[model samples]
Target chain A: MKKEHVKIANREALIGVGLVIFNFVWWFAFAYGLGSKDPQEYTYVFGLPAWFFYSCVVGFIIMAVLVTIVVKKFFVAIPFDEEVEE
Target chain B: MNWESLIPLILFIIIIFCVGIWSGGYLKKSTSFAQDYFLGGRSLGGFVLAMTMTATYGSASSFIGGPGTAYNQGLGWVLLAMSQVATGYFVLMILGKKFAVVTRRYNALTMVDFLKQRYQSKWVVILSAVSIIIFLFSAMAAQWIGGARLIESLIGIEYTTALFIFAVSVLIYVTVGGFRAVALTDAIQGSVMFVGTLILLIAVIIAGGGIPNIIADLTAENPNLITPFGADGSLTPTYVSSFWILVGVGVVALPQIAIRAMSYKSSQSMHRAIIIGTIVVGVIMLNMHLIGVFARPILPGIEVGDRVMPLIALEVMPNWLAGIVLAAPMAAIMSTVDSLLLLVSSTIVKDVYLNYVKPTASDQRVKRLSITITAILGVIVFIMALNPPDLIIWLNLFAFGGLEAAFIWPIVLGLYWSKGNKYGALGSMVAGVGLYILSDSFFPQPFGLHSVVMPIVVSFFVYIAASLATQKKTV
Candidate 1:
């Protein structure tokens, strides 16, 4: 009974939330999982600590690209001027 | 005093003033004065929509306080701050087309207007207006103090003088031009922030003799500095992850931000904004915090955290270039201030005044009242900022938490849940705000999570329970 645009928005919102959870899981895993190790035992990637490089640096790039793809693929553009059915 | 450094900032202010004056012309030509002045007549394009959201959200904290914390906490704070990467995406997508179509159908100009029409309750509108006024006053005061302090230090002038100058610049543009002025200036300011952070990061890395040497220096100083647990091991994974609520998902509730969802021209603009806003927020946030962590070796033993950004910029870059680069923070502060000012003004003029004070007030009267209220609000905030509290960052954060707790459930559940009614909104807001204050004060950071988390969680249940309990009566 809901409008098509609202249904699309609801689906897109679920994807958005999924992406957020994915981002947090990705961040938390690399950050706390790899990062909890001792500093002397740490590795480096591109001059950043291995944990930070993976968690923040790589996390940022992956999220950006993933978001772009998700929006382009899954998200549909609905008209703003359409009337809402009460 | 370095005259070279002052030129770019002064020029920046001059250009902002010109934009304000230019946009004011549209205010005159518009058919609906309130819509044009408050929401820009829904004419925003994709790029401007993205930039305005970025610039408005990137306040003094992101530009100044964030880096300073990064300096103190090390790489962990950078990880913590990255929780904000999905802010614009969450706001635009979750609200998305439904919010825009519904608001247009209701003829809602402000977030409170949407709430008012949706709930059909006088109390909901009043509570929303009051919460916005109270919380945003503190937020605006924080911005005012930050702007003054930035100008005071950069130009080597007295704090009072800097405050006066800063107050005048913001008041004139916002009072004259309204939301269009805020959005256009935000576009300019957002660009400045992007380019400025990029330049400063590269310069800081170079000054530190490359990233490898900087990491080495940090390791030699304290191995903990390179870890994800912060310098003192206080940034627990639990606490850091909880920020996903405070800065990440809960941001959709902020009136200054939520209103952006209603202002874009089309779904194409919204689509474009989600992509652009996500990337820009990522780039600026990562670069700024990284610069903070990287600056520690170059300028060792800085006492205050807020001073880290300006001091590092001056140290790593030439004065003239530093001046230009430093405009990013200034841009951040002003953009936030103008948006908050206009928002608070509209809350009073559109929501409170028109609804209660005089429903039949003429358009001319309403327009005049909005401009006057904006200017008056600026002056009041300026005065409050004159004797600044020592913990301005905490003040800003408190405002964020308070606003989020008060409105998050009501706005979000109200939009999606058909069973959500006025009683449910009232219960959720009262419980959320009351519990947030009690927890923030008496039991600070229960279970190693930020204070905002519990209230938001509990409020969700309160909203559902209250709504279901009252469903039959309303029906």
Candidate 2:
């Protein structure tokens, strides 16, 4: 039982790190990859530059949704009262 | 000063004081005064837990200094600041269940308590306490200055008088109510920040004649303002990416935020907090920084970046509505100040005084000391804030980097890696902090990365080497 609990926590932490990396890759790519273009050549989405529109605005919604799903599906509710034996 | 705007702020302060006093009543009837006062008896629920973490993490830096910097740097800064969206998620998720179980098993009140029990080293406790006090002092001073600056601009009061008022208000409630007061006030403050950010964003966009017009003005002035490289192209891709470590992953080591991980009522609250916190932080950070970038077209050439948030709000909205919206930054500053004040006080009283000074001290004595220490720390920070930096964000970020450097590896590796011993923890902190200061002062942005990255990287190896070298000694 104890080993299983530790495994669950480790798995969740990995998922958390995975989400962070995924968010960073998305943010960096859109921010720099597309944003590296000249200003005169930029496209607008809702008044924000295309890069920002994708990186920050769209990225935020994606992260919020992804995080909600991850928490609901991947995270297991663990008891806080009992002291885990070392 | 417009009296209409000041009324809402005054009303907000009054409500916070009432909450503080109400929570103080609980302090006296608690079975475990230390636990109740320091950790809020670990009874935090979902919404309160999420809000408190959000409020505490979203300090004057995020509300005032962040917008100020974003206003200067333009949209690039906003992209960099968005790294914070995952802050609450990382803290709650990585440290969520295991941290709560272990700390509860150890009956640890502060982060230092956990370090002390886990490492069983006097140096570890002393170092943790010292680093928290040193780093959090600057962090607290940043909040105090932000508070005073907001009050000074809003009410048109003298800086000294504003500082005095801000300091007194925070000390009164924090000393009276403890963590419960801080957490409760944080819930209110966090909500204020969310609504304020949304309202101000829409107002700024409308005032700037919408997004297309604003982007046009920005391009006319400097095309780089709308780019990812900042107004002057100083925000390099390398530097921006490193911030993912500074504000993103490394935040788990912040004592003020980490303590919240152990104080929640159950796993359900942690899970709930993770979702709620991620969404709130995303919305608030994205909107607040966007407001900073958007305000550029409306209010151009503001010399002080911190003044942008208040100046733009007053310019775009009616005086009454401006006052109410401005309370959001005020709430952010106060919530952060109260939490830091409590954290430093706990480090001094619970970690240092109780552990080393007098282990046999009575509950009443500890309680009195905690209150007294909290007030004293507030006064000291007020003194530090009097000579404010032109941009308080650097000071706040400097504190963040230093604390993360010192605590990140020890806290994370200690939990996961069984081979992590006292030598490793101690070695990591010393190397991390030492290298961080050296890099920050002499060789900032070495290799085009933030100074924090090197120290954190170097210390991770140092932790493993030191731990492996000393394995036989422990056995």
Candidate 3:
């Protein structure tokens, strides 16, 4: 039971880390990859035309809130069951 | 003082005082003095919870210093500052039900109480107390300086005298009513923050003519100002990416923010706070920073960054409205200082004095010590503020970095990992502090990464390895 709980938590933690990494990379790709403007030219993504460190915060905030909901609702306790071992 | 300009500020003070008196009544009548004073008797509703969280988190940095940096750095700093929009959501989400449930179970008034009960070690209690007292004092001193400077600029008073008056005002309200006053005033101030940012942004746009005109002016002034790398290209990719660790993820460790996570009454309140707080923080941060850049075209040359907001407001709006609008930052600084002062005082009064000095101290004595220490802390911080820096943004950031470096691993790892025992917490803290200071003094950014990166990495290994090794020994 404890192992299951740890598994779920570890999964969530990894997903959390992954999302931010993805967003940062998306920003770099959008700014410099296909959308690579010259150093002198202004960088813009769509109408915004920016490297998305700040706007990506909106995505992060939503993810954080959703994680809290998931932790509160779906992430149920399995309780400690230590007697039966692998 | 100009009566016209001072009227809104006067009204703000009067309203805050009334709330303090009312909350003081509630506090006096409560069964648990510490609970009432420290955590609002754990009865805060969703709206109050959301507002208080927003106000507490939005410090002088958010309102004044952040925008000031934005003014100089142009829109890039805005991009960077918005990374903090997730702060409120992160706090509520990360330290939600577990922290609240565990804190209540432990009857913890402060973060140290939670740590003490969790670790059952006197060392954890002592170190947490010392860190809170030392680092929070520096943070509090920065807010005090910001407040004094704001008042000085607004009312045309000498900075020292203004500091004295502002010091007395905050100390008196907080000392008398404690967390209740802070929370209630936070609601008022938080609304002011949202409205003030809105009004100021609109006024700035009009002052600059419009976004297109503002862009043209900015391009004419310096084209690089609009880019991601900042004017001098100091904001490198590595440095910008590393800041995510500082202001974004690692903010979870700040005691001031961490304690907020433990304050609300219910999970529903926490959930509501997450939603409401994100929207508000996003609006405030985006608009304030945009105003910083927008103000550049409007008010061409301002030497000091801190004065940007005050000068912009006065330049565009009426002096009277400027004072009232400017009260938002004042509110932000005061709310932050009040919370930090109380947190530090509790670190001394509850964590140290009650735990070690006299475990059997009566309620009256605890209350007395809390108030006295808070006042003393306020006075000390005021003295520290007399010689203010030109831009307080750096001072505030240093304090932020110091606190995050000092507390992040111990608090976060302590919560999740069961193997995280006392030795691990100690070693992690030592590693974090040691590396942080070393990097701070010698090379703030090693290989273009921020100073905090190396320390955090070192601390993580110290925490995990030390905990694993210590666990075997204990077994």
Score chain A of each prediction against the true chain A by TM-score and list the results: 0.91, 0.92, 0.45
Q: Give the winner by lDDT.
A: 2
For each candidate in the order shown, give its overall lDDT on alpha carbons: 0.89, 0.89, 0.74
| Candidate numbers, best TM-score first, in rank order | 1, 2, 3
Q: After superposition, how far is residue B291 of candidate 2 from its true place, in Å?
A: 0.8
The number of the candidate with the highest TM-score is: 1
Deviation from native of the Cα of residue B249 in model 2, angstroms: 0.8
Instruction: Judge the docking of candidate 2 as incorrect, acceptable, medium or high.
Output: high
Q: Model 3: residues >4 Å from true position, as ranges?
A: A1-36, A39-86, B60-64, B387-398
lDDT of 1 by residue, A1-86 (tens): 24787789789888888999899999989998888888988899999988899988899899889988988888887777754455
Residue pairs with backbone atoms closer than 3 Å in model 1 (clashes): none
lDDT of 3 by residue, A1-86 (tens): 25565565455445445544654555445433422344345544432345443244345455456645554665433322124447
**Which residue pairs collide in model 2, if any?**
none
lDDT of each residue in B1-475, candidate 3, tens digit only = 7777789987887888888777878877777777788888877766777787778777734532588888888766876776666565666555555566557667887888887887787887787788677777777877787788888888899988999988988888888888878888888889998999899888888887777688768867887677766777687767876776787778778887777777776656766676677678767777878888889988878888878888899899997888789888888888888888888887888888889899998888777777788888877777778875544434455567766776787777776777888888778877887788789779889989989888988889998898898887656
Lowest summed lDDT window (length 10), candidate 3 chain B: B388-397
Q: With candidate 2 superimposed using the best TM-score fit, by how many Å does residue B49's alpha carbon deviate from the native?
A: 1.4
User: What tens-digit string does per-residue lDDT give for candidate 1 at B87-119?
Assistant: 958889888888888888888999999999989
* TM-score of chain A taken by itself, candidate 2: 0.92
Error of 2 at A45 (Å): 1.4
